[model samples]
Target: MNSTSKGDRLEDAFYHYLLDQQDRGELIFGAYPPENCRIYRKKAYYCREREADVEFDVVLELYRKGRDTPHLYVIFECKNHEASISEVYVNDFSSKIGRIFPHAVKGVMVVTSRLQAGAEKVARNARMGIVKYDEQGLEIIADRRGSCFEHSFVRSQIFRSANSAKSLKFSAYHDGEYFSSIDRFLGSLEPELVDGIRPENGGGSLPVPYLSIEQIKAAAGKILKFADYESGAVDLVKVCQSLSIDLQFADRAVLDADGVAILGSANFGRKAIEINSHSRETRERFTIAHEIGHFCLNHERYLRSETIIERDLFVTREKDGSFNYERLEYQANAFSAELLLPDAVFLKKTAHFRRDLEMRDRGHGYIFVDDQPGNSATYDELLSRLSTHFEVSKQAIEVKLKKSKMLTDQRKRNEASPISRVFAGLISSRKS
Candidate 1:
């Protein structure tokens, strides 16, 4: 049995579990809890089209001042712990849903338990799905179901991750029903997936624009216009120091928390990055590194952009899915990507990227790197070199080649040129 002293320990445990899962995948994230959106549970409002009188538990308003307001959706409902049905509950919630979700293609349900067989029949009559806790963890997610806390967090992330959609809207959260500056991020449920990370051309079989992530980073750096690539992050820190005159660099924050960096003289003097106690070691470090990238690559863009206000860097979020998807937030993400993995750095070492793959451990996925230039020219040598260096399956190297644009279509299809289909098939079979 779970300890109930806190706000549902089992539910809280699941929240932690969700964090763990996000780390293993590619979800840029943030956390929004139930208390923040509590008001959304009890706000009085007229029905859509003024057809009836009703109040909303969660009212997701669409983006205001945005041309794309149609993209966002809102929902609200009560959560229960019981498995029994209540028609009164449905009648009230259904009315609210019809109002706020005027054209809502998606929905948010704050409900009690996952369905019981009898409850399912009742739910069908409501023309919607009920979000309930699954004790057995065997539920299919046709509807995006989560606990009050979990649902809020996911919706916040989803809206945040919409990336300049201008679909940012207001809702609930642990903090309250306010606007979140950075939109919510798309969430994932994996913790250790190792695919679709690097482009393939660097491995030397294709026309990948560059050799590696470093190269990609470098190219992006020029595109972003850094003062000097040689200075790299050191130059970036200096810039941050200068920006601190008008900025605030956060010394610490929980992972994916609503964060801001203060160039506060006192805060800067403390060297926020050096403070370990207040932030998540891994996430904070990663975020700092990412911010440094932005500093190096995007400062000019931000300074020159007319839409961003001096104090606009900070936005707010309610507990559930409430945020703004336009402007600076996504810009920061692009900055982080370009700074951390510049294109030139990766391009310079493109021929040798396969050599790094030798370090991959089995069950961890495959990697390949080559050393000898003479041997690097041949596909077999390159593949062998990558296998030894990265410890990845040869098939992975092939995909990497495809991503890089190194292999020719004929080689992949025909059985005659430098590589044969039959031969490729044979090599693919020996992945073990």
Candidate 2:
């Protein structure tokens, strides 16, 4: 017979989990258990819209002891099931949250299985959150905080991996939304490059000259000289400025696009790079590096005019469900990966750190760098560490590792669940 009740076990698990998050300084209060905290288990709230009372799994709040306005409030609806969490569940949670709590309260739908397609988007649109926790460490599927905590979260690397719409623009730069930013960027360029910058014709009638892989590699090598190869991190802004390229940050709405842009010979008589200000620092750095690929590979030579603008040479996809593999975009993406985390250094660090990790025999999932032996880290920890050292996102590191055959290729070595295959597939598809 089971000793503990399921309800009691769930409550205890969540209580302890929150306590651990508190100790780790994940909570906004910055105090363990926090002051004036209230965790109402199986609480009922009257829903004005529904004209009925809805019961919640857990309602957690932390704020000033006597203040009328709460600093932070989170409502979590737990779902333990084999099926994935769908849009319907997310919509229901959003509706309940709207009726039950103030606008500032963040709604969280905690699920055991994965989230279905469009579910996360629904949650984000509703200003709610999603958490997928299991024996593996806590994976924040989606967590949209209220305005008060948003600034802090944006600055926190802990929540840096949240999914955003910006990633979509990389696939199709020609989308209607992207034209505004592209036009602005093109208009800012100098007349010389903007007016008559065309590829050197080589007897063929083709107007543009396609760069070879060797040429791209050579260009990347030049940029890598300015970076710390051992650390696999480059000062992209400094490198750009060294080449007379100005770095500019603009809002996403202004760009109507994702990623960064390399402006050839701006009106200031210098090259420029426009990065999406709303993106994370890691993302900005990668975008800068990607743009550097374009500069070094002489992609501007292909630009004919402002009206016929060349697609960004980093992330442009073609029809038939495949990326434009034979284009400058693919080459630039390849260059960015190689530049950000050089193969040799990346492999060496992973080999050494993973060896040490193996000796320690730590557990899986998110782990602090200096975590204890029994509470060891996962591939995610390794990726996070590399990301910090390399100044990129864990996803970037993971992709690099996979490309280098360190995360895959079982013939070389054997390790159970080197990384989450599901996560790897998800991230890979997202990139494509």
Best by the lDDT measure? 2
Candidate 2 accuracy as lDDT: 0.47
TM-score of each: 0.27, 0.39
Whole-model lDDT per candidate: 0.33, 0.47
RMSD of each: 18.5, 21.5
RMSD of 2: 21.5
Instruction: Estimate, for each residue in 353-409, the C-alpha lDDT of model 1 and write its tens digit.
Output: 545433332342233224444323455655555544433334434544544444433
> Model 1 residue 99 lDDT?
58
Clash count per candidate = 78, 2
Model 2: ten consecutive residues of lowest lDDT: 169-178
